[model samples]
Target: MTSLSVLNSALLVLSVALVLLHVSATRAKPNKARTLFAIFCGSIAFLMCKQLSAASIGPYQFLIGIGASATCNAYWLFSRVFFRRRDAIKPQHLYVAVAIALLVAMNQIYMFLKGMAVFTPAPDALVRYILVELTLLLSSCILVLTFWEGCRGFGKDTFEGKAQRILFLSVFVFALAGSKIAKGLLADNPQALEYIISAITLLVMVSTQILLMWRYTNHLDFLTTIPLRERLQPSAATDATKATDSRGELSPLARQIRDLIIGQAQYLQENLKVSDIARELDAPEYLISKAIRTELGAANFNQYVNTLRIAHAQTLLADPDHLKTSILAIGLDSGFASVGPFTRAFKTKTGLTPSEYRQNLQAK
Candidate 1:
């Protein structure tokens, strides 16, 4: 291997290790979506390792080939369940996996009996490559469709459907890498193309590792479930005050409500129920509700709570430090249990999807 290839391969191995560690760590948690995400990471790690080592073709390749095929298929299945997509748990899906695994295992046994270590690259390789690519494309389409549907609802603002987007993007990169590998399998100049494909794939794998870590751990503290650092600095408050103060008329009660909501967010977590805030401030529930209504220009108590949640969620989303975090999980932890309401509030406030907002943050 050339120095560059060695370096790239080493990096790929490191990425695989990181992902595996993340999967192990998250395994104990009963979070279905997160656990599925961990499995997705593991599958990618296995695929990358196979590419790096160049699976011995034939029986070994056959086994590895089946694993590789199943890994990609599993990713789509996992995504459906993770994203709450329907028909994910149907009998047909389970049967398909079992049938594929059986066939692949049978092929491996047959080749081994023939005293072959690897199967020769036969006409089947072409058919398998096309099928795998088509499957990946189908998965991509499903992801895109889910994201689009999620966007149509207010839930897009919350971290709800963003997983689909991230998963799709990761899959897209993998598919592109697979395309290069497929080309190598079919055409001349396989060696150089293999290295280039490996390099690009290494980049994608590294990005996936970073995102998985960020989503599951507080490696970047700013991406923590609870807001730790102050966002919308105190100066932002002063600005809001400045605008209101210029009129030489500030409603003390309304100002108090605003300060309480914004201040509680800055320090304490999202435990501020309207009644709790009302009791702490020694105000009537109705009066406190009135103050929030008039001051924040929002309707009802739940809307007020969601406003605060969305505000905090935005702060996390906007933070350059949290670009890797899961927007949906962040939304949930931010106190918006559902993505629809979160996305609506987010779009209403920021006029962009969580992914778009993150992209904008990255652009900056």
Candidate 2:
């Protein structure tokens, strides 16, 4: 094998290993991020195998070709599943993936038939050109979407979360997109240049997987939002004791702030802000934020308030008396400005939509 083929072989092995690792790790827990990550890795593996032998023709190669073509789509979905707290993989997302896959498959089948001399196109035919442009357009849009997803909610993320987001945008989004643009611009370059570009791209991908594995093994919570139980149940104390213990963890000013919020149920105000809390407590806004972050272990004032709101919403969700109450009304009563943020936050914490959680309660 040539040196390029040997490098591709090594990358293929590494990519396949990462896929297996992600799949094995998620087998017992069924983590959506890890599962999607496995698919992303599999897509990389397919690309590497394609590079090793570009002219392979068979049913299996056709399927693998489709997968290699959907690399951008797979990474886009993986980014959404990784970064977004809400329902990331909606029905529309699946439809788009299927559509992209089908488009690529059609192009591949066209090429296969032409190569076998079973089909021919007119000299003026635009079918091939149109299909190629459409695929490129869709892939570019998906890349842009992936970057947007990585940027979304960045201001609200924890320090670790922000770092992970930045890392992904730098390593995967920019690197892959740059490689594609370079390849397109250099379409007539020698085959060796293509191999060099592919090697660099594969190296970047392998490095990303290594970093992700390190993050996963280190129990980094950046990949997902904090669970509701961890946010609420910090210890084994009873509710009354828990209240006292929670207050005890804070400084005197923080305790006073907590008392003012909890004692008067200020969290139900819906438009509550740190400035409002600071004004009521005769304290500075920065101090109030610091108290929440340091004493409450929250990423910010909003997270602290949302934790309380989600806890309250959980109570109302499980209440038999409020079984007939509208979810929107319950969410509003719990201090959410609107249903969208409320639903997203609730799902991030609890891994269930408001409706699903309520339904589960009813089932129980």
Candidate 3:
């Protein structure tokens, strides 16, 4: 191998080894999701090293194909863990995996039998490359969606959310790497594409490994402090049940509540009330009232709303955008009934008022 190849191989090998060690060490843990994530990282590393070598391209192509397929397969498993899917990996999910694997196998066989370049494209390069990019891109999106879905209904506040966020972010960066691969195939820019893809893959690998180690070794579980008992109030359970069926399927209302809380976390500063949410949702006021009290463990209705609003305002106050927006406006928008409540809540939650939080964020 040339100097450049040797250097690249060394980097790839080191990265893979580090990630593999973490994955192997964590395999005995009870967290299946973490284990699967480790496996996913190992697979990605294998593909990265294979692609870097470009020796005959067949191994590279096969690894890439399996990696793409595995990325999607991992999503179902992730969702199952996130949602506590009782059925485990269902037959349909397996069927989908089998289908993707079959495609990868067929693509690899055709490339090998036809004496085609594994990494390089022929006249049909555009079509082939597009398929590759789409497969990986779609798989990354699926994983992200699973994480997003899991964030609802007391999901975002847990270790799962943090893990999901990190994993999804890594997957997104990796998708960028795959996109570079496709770009290289489509255009004549070989060296630029190779370097870009390699760098991105390296970044993704490092981030993913760190996350795996932190989650497994540190036993870090985000949002685990929130009590499950408080989250299971009857009214909330009814709402939850409404959101999920007797079969524990996700209800539309459940999804709506998750979207409302998680997506508009920033908007909580508007001093939102249960009645306001009910009006906004077009659901009955009693149901919303019951849901919050039961699901959230709020001693009083107003406190419940302020909790989210205050948290959001704290984030804004700590953001660079605080320079553009006033503390009072942020308070009001965060659903604070008045300046006093906002200030008190902000201080209590963050040990700083809105103004102070913003100052700190800017300083950082």
Candidate 4:
């Protein structure tokens, strides 16, 4: 039989490798979330080393400079970076990340100092239990905050899809936490039971990593070039369901919205609003919402606008007549605030830098 400690060590090692694999794959020009995720993975690896060692044959309850709060914050920050738009990852986000992790680190450091200063003869068991509970509460609160924002920001009207996924995660997390609490109630049981619980924790962590990767690839990373309307509306559906109004052959409302934005260059406005569009068209807010999101199949308004900007930039880059135009100028002309975001967005859509794209056009 495999020893629990050895199993934990193996699992932790596997998880570390997976995290490192993702970081390496995206490192050429690492995204903001990718960098933050790397830091989180590194911290978790260090903690796992200490915990696995203590369980198997190392020091007793040694501190590893990271704890529950740090891991929880890492999870939250990863979600933020992964879902937010390319330009959304700003300096303030870095400050916020540092602030959250620093708060937990400071508390731990202060407690460690206090312990050294007031070495009591007898260890306070109740105090330790209370501290554990507080840590769990803090971590749970952070998870709540992360989940709310993460699902909200995911494109494609994700309130139903992504939010449901987060709900599933919440159930899994609480169920695991409950199991631990139940195990603690079995204090009179054999010492080996503790090892079993640790093994379960290791399994849970591995499963979480797998779920995250699967979700990222399956839904978030799965790009589609087809028109959004076709994906949702099956070919076998009746023609009557197509709702052919004056909007156009595709979707009259959707086409109207697109034409107004494209022809008038409304996308050039950085702070465009759904309400504003609705008011201009004298349509109800939900009607316009349905036009863009349900009928058009855009992830959200921002994504729809980004598509226009990226497509426009592509045209400018590929135009032989505009051979002397600077990439930065094209990016700005296409509604991007700066060259960095413009480049990232362009690469994301076309899988090439503006220069490379231009060169390819010339070659063809």
Cα error, candidate 1, residue 198 (Å): 2.2
Where is model 4 more than 4 Å wrong at Cα? 1-29, 55-63, 67-69, 83-100, 103-137, 150-364
lDDT of 3 by residue, 19-109 (tens): 5648654553334456556555655555555555555554445535444345445545644543432234668766765665555555555
- Model 4 clash count equals 3
Q: Candidate 1 on 36-101: residue-level lDDT in tens?
A: 445555555655554544434433544443344344445445444433322235687656545544
Q: Which stretches of candidate 2 lie over 4 Å from their true place?
A: 1-27, 55-63, 177-195, 207-217, 220-364
Q: Please provide, for model 2 over 1-364, each residue's C-alpha lDDT reduced to its tens digit, 9 standing for 90 to 100.
A: 3465656555656565465646545653334556666676666666566555554453345445666655678768877766654456889998887777778888877766665666667752598898889898997788789889889977544344567877877776557766767778777864655565656656655665654554453432221234334544454223433343455445778766765555334666667888878866789999998876666556788877787788778877887867887888879877888999999998877778889999987898
For 271-321, candidate 4 gives per-residue lDDT tens digits of: 567876776567887877777666554657777777777766765676665
1 or 3: which has the higher lDDT?
Answer: 3
Candidates ranked, most accurate by TM-score first: 2, 4, 3, 1
Model 4, residue 86: what's the lDDT?
A: 29
TM-score of each: 0.43, 0.56, 0.44, 0.45
Off by over 4 Å in 3: 1-14, 56-69, 79-88, 116-167, 170-187, 213-364
In model 4, the clashing pairs are 156-299, 247-252, 248-252
Best by lDDT: 2
Q: lDDT score, residue 74, model 1?
A: 51
Candidate 3 local Cα displacement, residue 8, angstroms? 1.1
TM-score of 4: 0.45
Q: TM-score winner among the candidates?
A: 2
